[model samples]
Target: MKKNSINRVIGFVIVGLVLLAAVIETGRSVYTWSQQAAKQPRYTIVIDPGHGGNDPGKIGINDVPEKDVNLAISLELKEILEQNDCRVVMTRQKDEALYQAGDTNKKVADLRARCQMINDSGADAVISIHQNSFTAESSRGAQVFYRASSQEGKKLADILQTQLVSGLDPDNRRVAKANSDYFMLKNTTATMVIVECGFLSNSKEAELLTQASYQRRVAWAVALGVLQYVSGGLS
Candidate 1:
């Protein structure tokens, strides 16, 4: 019963994201009828909002936590995808660790567990959310990364970053290929792309990252980018 309740809560949150995406998609559709009656989309998109629970990734100018931002944007992304009819799964809902407490090897075991969840979900693709930080605030903009082992991973990264640049920012931040050393990217069985949405350390970008409106737009860009890739528009 406890596990079932947790699953329900998770589902509600995921469905909320899907609904937000649906509402946006419905508004943009050629007509409401097409959106209402369209057959279910043929893809399942697993959204892994990185660094939750005690792992609060990069701290921003206002001390905004990276885990919180990732969750917010990830929820928005799930909305955009579900509006377009994609099934979605999330790694964690509240700010809880994926692994049980008191585990000796927590970090690696936890990360691998997250990957196992994605692999078990039978998702077509996984998008791991993260925020970036560097000494250079000038290093602002979105970047998509893929595992070196997967060729299609490169294509997915290209499409997502291209769409983000063209639709959200015209600053061509470029796509990167990373080896399995990145934990999540290296271990997930599904076609995976990790997104460094923007640099949080930069004052200007940090301000934008904190806004709900901008987050939704970023989510939309990501959703469309993946769809474009899936539809063969970015090949």
Candidate 2:
């Protein structure tokens, strides 16, 4: 072969080898990225259906019991959370009451039992769901409450509010705050939030609460909020 032809042949072989090396590197990068994605933490979130059994909670003008509403919302919320790859645990999955109320303290004891379940579930946080009611029919909108002294609770609540407001309502009504009176908020070992999902006393809000479409929206917004917290941090 001519010397010039031999040199050209060598140059082509070198270029081919370089191209092959580039292809291998690109494939390896993609495979490594996918593996890292698969290894990311799959967080678990616990949902508490506030008020059950004899504890009817606040009754609406339409005679819709608070416990029923709490459970319904909670079940929907669980579905949303699970859809987003979060493992969910519910304190009450159905329309049963939580406390027997044998005595004034019996109700407290029952609440403690429920709280212990959330604490023991090994969940990152507990979202205790409930509906609000007041003498004023005009009262409406969702609210989020948290343990005032808990740094983790505050962090989750803050992220939740940012996510909740993004798609649900622009208003900051559902922000987290110190709520010492709630038994669940006070007792749970993990960071806790008690969400009052609108006022049943308000006629318009009460009607909206019972609708399936509205419930789905509420659940989705809640799940997004919770995810933002879980993915973020307690702070």
Instruction: Name the best candidate (by lDDT).
Output: 1
Candidate 2 TM-score, C-alpha based? 0.76
Instruction: Tell me the tens digit of each residue's lDDT in model 2 across 85-109.
Output: 7888887887665655475676787
For all predicted structures, in order, the TM-scores are 0.79, 0.76
As for candidate 1, its clashing pairs are 17-79, 21-79, 21-80, 21-83, 22-83, 180-186
Per-residue C-alpha lDDT of model 1 across residues 129-193, encoded as one tens digit per residue: 89989997677888888998888888888788888888778866566656667888767777899
